[model samples]
Target: MSLEIRKIVSFEEETLIEGYKKADRPLRMFAVAAVVTNPWAGRFVHDLKPVVREYGPQLGELLTQRICELAGGAENIEAFGKAAVVGLNGEVEHASALIHTLHFGNFYREAVEAKSFLSFTNTRGPANAPISVPMMDKNDGGKRSHYLTLQFNIGDAPAADEIVVVLGGATGGRPHHRIGDRYQELQELGHDVDNPAAV
Candidate 1:
């Protein structure tokens, strides 16, 4: 089935100053959102896989393409994440159904050649709700410096019968990262940083 897309929203944010100092370079972030009709709103659906399978790839590809364009290219995306917001009439699972599938996430992952899974949030809310997209290093989940969040909202989205799916990216990590990575903390605790299983 073809997706019932209502609208697509694109956002970009750049941090040029950090901690009252000028950044050597801007830290760029991007997000692309698609507001689509919720197929199972206001009702319990025993099966979601059919819609998931049918819609995941298309949504994934469309959003990833916009992200790449906004970030200049997939290779420039150092951190990435996703989010979904279901309208009041829908379940949180309705939002998840569109984004949590491998069929949906793989497009962005493969495009950026990432090693870490895409971080995500699935929630239910009203129109114009805060859309939070949490991100981490595209290649390294333990990289504390690359943790990021993108926040934006649509004024009239997910109108009690819609879902908003989003994909987000960052050009690089924090402008001045003083804190070390997770590996350092792990090593301090006497865990084998190189061999996580041994810990």
Candidate 2:
């Protein structure tokens, strides 16, 4: 099924610090959102896979490209994530149907060559509802410093029978990450940190 996109929204944020001191470079985050009609709203569909499969790749490409552009370029994006919010007339599953599949997610992953799966959220909400997208290191999901969340809201969207789909990107991790890396934590524990199954 083809998605009927009503409008698009974009958000950007720059964080400079966690405490008193600020870093030389600010951490930049960007998000791209699409407001679209929900094809299966107000009813239950026994099968959702086909619907998702049909539209996933297109949505992934479109959203990813937009966010990458907003952030300067895909190569500059260090972390990534996605989210969806369904309107009151639609169920949460309607949000899930558009985002949870690799058919859509893998496109973004491959575009950025991200190793970790895209972090995500799916829920039901009304216009002006807050939307949060949690991002992880594009190459190393275990990097705690790279974990971040970008939040925003559309002033007018998801007006029942609609869904808001978002894709987020970051140019860097937290500016002043002094907590140390995950590998260092594993090392201090004196465990087989290199073994994938041992942890």
Candidate 3:
């Protein structure tokens, strides 16, 4: 079955000053979402394979392209993530199915030339629900400074039988990041920097 898309929304913001100080460089974050009709809503589907397979690539490619364009290009996106919010009538598993697959995530990963796995969140909510896509350094997950969350909401979306799929990106980390990275914290804690599990 073809995915029935209702509307597409884009969110963009640039932070020039933060924490009462001017940023070294303006930080920008972008996200794009698609509200689509849920094919399996209000029903129990033992196997979601067909739906997932059919929708993943299309949603991934569509959302990834929009988000990249919002960021000016994949090169400008240093941190990235994905999220999905299923309507109240649908199961959270539906949200997870669409975004957690390789078909969906590989597009963004390849586009950004990222080494790290795409961060994600999947949940169930109603229209105007808060959508938060948590991101991390495209190449370095341990880089705490690049940890970010792009937040937005569609005034009318994800109706009882709909799902909102999203992709997000950030140009840089928090403008006033001083806490250093995960590796540094490990070293300070006397843990092996190379092997975090070793004391």
By lDDT, the better pick of 1 and 3 is 1
Off by over 4 Å in 3: none
Q: Candidates' TM-scores?
A: 0.97, 0.92, 0.97
Arranged by TM-score, best first: 1, 3, 2
RMSD each, Å? 1.0, 1.7, 0.9
Stretches off by above 4 angstroms in model 2 are 195-199
Kindly give the stretch of ten consecutive residues in candidate 2 with the minimal lDDT sum.
190-199
Residue-level lDDT of model 3, residues 132-160, one tens digit each, is: 99999999999999999989999888899
User: What does candidate 2's lDDT look like per residue over 26-72, in tens digits?
Assistant: 98988999998898988988898887887788788899889878988
Distance (Å) between predicted and true CA of 127, model 3? 0.5
TM-score of 1: 0.97
Which pairs of residues have clashing backbones in candidate 2? Answer: none
lDDT of each structure? 0.94, 0.88, 0.93
Q: Model 1, range 89-197, lDDT digits (tens) per residue?
A: 9999999999999999999999999999999999999999999999999999999989998999999987999999999999999999889899988888888998866
